[model samples]
Target: MAKLVLTRLGGTLKGRALTPNPLPRILWRSLSTEGESQDPSIDPFLHSAPEGLAFGRLTGIGRNTLKTDVIHYLEGCKLSINDVKFDYNRAYTPVGVLLQFPSRSSFDLAVRQTIRKGRLYKLEKIDRSEWDLKTSYDGKAVLLQGVPRNALQEDVERFLSGCNFDPSSFQTFVRPGFPDPIRVAIIQFPTQVDAMNAFCVKNRSFCLNNPISMRVLQ
Candidate 1:
């Protein structure tokens, strides 16, 4: 397992009151229990607004930061990550397939919004602690872990229906045999077993002869 050594959360200043960046909101996923999924209704990551926060509520500064891809920027840092694993799984959510989008920023924005919507099953945040950073695989992958959410297939399909991109333009499958729309994909897994089950399902529409390769932080 990757060691989480950093304990202090950073903050930003809005005039005089110190406040946390949303990245810390993302990090709350890391602080939650391992492997055990939680109720979406109770997730702190989704409920971050202080008591009475509303969607689309943002200070000008926060708005700018809201659009910021904090996770994307952090992915480039030469840090340690430990106990990393990777496996190819069927495309389950828009983010799973969207990760392959040519524009990284757009992909990041979509993911943040989806998580904020409060319905999908989420996993731990990418291990961003110094120890997790130091142990991460170099050049193999920038995004280390993902959590699957229970996205409404209809909701996702409706979102994609409006997109200019061809539904077929993205990767489709024969191994897992996904239909016109795939209902799920691997986001992040807490263990290799879970990741593998997600990736190498024997009866699923898609099938991987070999498990998708995963890497560990050295």
Candidate 2:
């Protein structure tokens, strides 16, 4: 039988029957003098979820630390759990755990993130002869990296207006803060160097180590 034990610290000990299967339940507890603060080792609860497990939570220093510990623990257990967390804020570097999830889940998460995150705009793919821009010039869509606070849609529009391509055809993405959403923008440039330059200058916040390919409709 599933047992649901609902407890709000200092409030009530409400108990509801729950399934025997191991799903999850919320255990709210008042900040007791003894458990006032979580120990770094036991923090972020996800680590305690059992080996070869998966979950999510609010992001913070403690959460991050917990993640590290969880990874180490998993390694010790000879287990690999798929980790997934939303980056609505876009502030957290989408590395480590971000790269750990299943590939399909990662792609779906990214698409959903693009929808709820923020306003999307188009930017030009500037090309310098140094990098490969052939694909971008072929009218294929490309991804640009940027941060929300720093991205100027107008500036991007104006810069791309003079280029051979239509500025309105592409989209711009700046990493937003917590609860915002994760997104990647698409654009077409004459060469890879231009695409790279724009990405570096605009999407500096993402710390994106590699560029993603875009499929241009036009």
Best by TM-score: 2
Task: Report the poorest 10 consecutive residues by lDDT, candidate 1.
Answer: 53-62
Computed on alpha carbons, the lDDT of every model, listed in order, comes to: 0.29, 0.39
Model 2 agreement with the true structure over 1-218: per-residue lDDT tens digits: 66678877778677777667666788987656774665666666865654332222222223223333434533322224234222223333322222132333433443354344452311111222212211212213344443233445564454444434346656665555356644545566665455545544544332223333322211
RMSD of each: 30.6, 26.0
Off by over 4 Å in 2: 1-142, 145-153, 158-166, 172-177, 182-184, 200-218
lDDT of 1 by residue, 145-205 (tens): 1111233334333323322222221222223333433223213334544433433432222
Among all windows of 10 consecutive residues in model 2, the one with the lowest summed lDDT is 121-130
Best by lDDT: 2
**Alpha-carbon error at 163 in model 2, in Å?**
8.0
How many steric clashes does model 2 contain? 27
